[model samples]
Target: MENKFRRIMRTEIHKGKRVHLFHDRLVTPTGKEVEWELIMHPGASAVIPIDEDGKIVMVRQYRNASDDYVLEIPAGVFDKPDEDPLVCAKRELEEEIGYTSEDVTFLYKFYSSIGICDEVIHIFVAKNLVLSEQNLDDDEFVTIERYTLDELVDMIFDGRLSDNKTISAIMTYKVSLERA
Candidate 1:
């Protein structure tokens, strides 16, 4: 069950607001030394907020990386290094979609990029949502959107939504619903 590679050294190449890039030297299982790039992240939490109307709350926001707007669930990185993912989820839900939930439950966790990044996304489902004021960041221009679970699945297959974490969380949420 041991699969961890031996890391000989890691040097920070650059530090950004959300991620730190490093040059890492590692020894392979075959005993060969190699250099690799790694991105260190503070991790984040996402929420699938379900309202009393049985609709899912989402947001449409512009992303600099893609130079276009993206539709995805409410999510944000931990405010503090040691902040709990659940707390982050709740805060993001209220911030991005202008709603808070009385019930939030963890669904699963996943790595964003196994090869290069140490970013882990914790997914949650929230119910009994209460309306509140949208408190987006000064730089965040977010628009609230609502959709049903079936509509999200259609968007995934139709290529309208391409955020990896969003797709993964939606699929997982659908499957969880089936099992329940």
Candidate 2:
């Protein structure tokens, strides 16, 4: 067996701080050629910070792409391509929610939008958290909130928590706890 898909060519369309857009031509297994627009991301890490009382730390902020305020777990893009994802998760948890976790366990990683983008998100469950000072980015305006695990699960099912990463991380953590 051999590879069925081949990238014919790629052209960078735009380059930004966090993402780069590209136009590419590919040849399929049937020998048909097509063009696709792809977004290249540096990847990111998200953390579900569960406190001793079982409350999860979350952040609410305006998302320009969606034109709405979204509730989500603390997350941040990898500072460098070689940066450790767990380190990124820890930094984001502290920076966004003012909590530092002594126990951070990796849950899973997945692509945010496989159809058009190459953005993988590493999810982690942070336990034994201690309060710290939030250090949000200059342009970031986030409000930290804590919710019971049950409330978060309800929000996920009721459509109140719609951010993909947040939902995935929350559900994954809950399932992991059940298994343990």
Candidate 3:
């Protein structure tokens, strides 16, 4: 009936392109105090772009952290905090995959990690994709890939896709389509 956790301290430890580190403390429901340590991320927007033919657009890139090439949806950091999620979604799509859509719809927004950090992710479905010259960041690296929705489902099941935000967006889009 009441909140169990209370934050006593939150201090920044490291800052990165997409993630930040935090040292924190909380008082538990049992009146016990504990240290909560984890990475803090500014959150991000992921785009599941579908073309006119219904093929889903994705990106393939080598993740330095994982030291492997991973398939993921187009995503990016929010340049302006006050900017709308949709705007970030569109910009990410163009910058990462070199595509844009006039029919982008917000799919879902959820927390990536909530236990120790306060990072939230906004996912979107962009339809009617059109090609444009890429505007990638100097440090950004990616290649575009298109897959049918069914194939994407298979990829998810086979573990070819491992990014949490991408997987969540694809599954949520499928569910939304079913509901409609």
Candidate 4:
């Protein structure tokens, strides 16, 4: 299958540090013209770093949009638009969690907000991690936490870990474990 949706025009609304907003004019399936707000992002990559003790690494950071400190898998946006998501994921695993891995594998990808944003997050699982010094960016404040896979599942059901990407990556990894 191929995408049939065609944009007639896209008018730029604003370009910020992280996202570009636009008003896109399109023709619906019913042939009606409509204008929709879209947020264009330089896609991101995330990692589920399972260390030697089988503990999954997580990051606790404050999200400005939600105005809350949230627990999530280590993730970051591409430094450039053409950057490979796998490369970004590898970098984040080291920078955010103080670990590096030679056995990184792609797990899944998804739009963070499909209806309004084009932020596709590429998720990966990194194993055989080597402990390294965390290299946090100047503006980043993150606390590292490690948990068992089952404990994370419990957190998901108990409404503790609420980040969608984290939930999705955990479940995806759990399922992968079952298959292996």
- Tens digits of per-residue lDDT for model 1 on 2-105? 56679999999999998999999998877789999999999999999998889988899999989999999999999777889999999999999998887999
Per-residue lDDT of 1-180 in model 2, one digit per residue for the tens?
A: 455889999999999999999999999888889999999999999998888888888899999989999999999999987789999999999999888987999899999999999999999989999989999999789998999988999999999998999988888888988999
Q: Give every collision pair in model 1.
A: none
The deviation in Å at residue 82 for candidate 1 is 1.4
After superposition, candidate 1 runs with Cα above 4 Å error:
1-4
Query: Worst lDDT window (10 residues) for model 3?
Result: 76-85
Candidate 1 whole-model C-alpha lDDT, 0 to 1: 0.93
- Between 3 and 4, whose lDDT is larger? 4
The local lDDT score (0 to 100) that residue 61 gets in candidate 3 is: 88
What would the TM-scores of all predictions be? 0.96, 0.96, 0.91, 0.95
Q: On lDDT, who's better, 2 or 3?
A: 2
Can you write out model 3's per-residue Cα lDDT over 38-58, one digit (the tens) per residue?
886666788998877878878
Residue-level error in angstroms, candidate 4, position 66: 1.4
Clashing pairs in 4: none
Q: Runs in model 2 with CA error above 4 Å?
A: 1-3
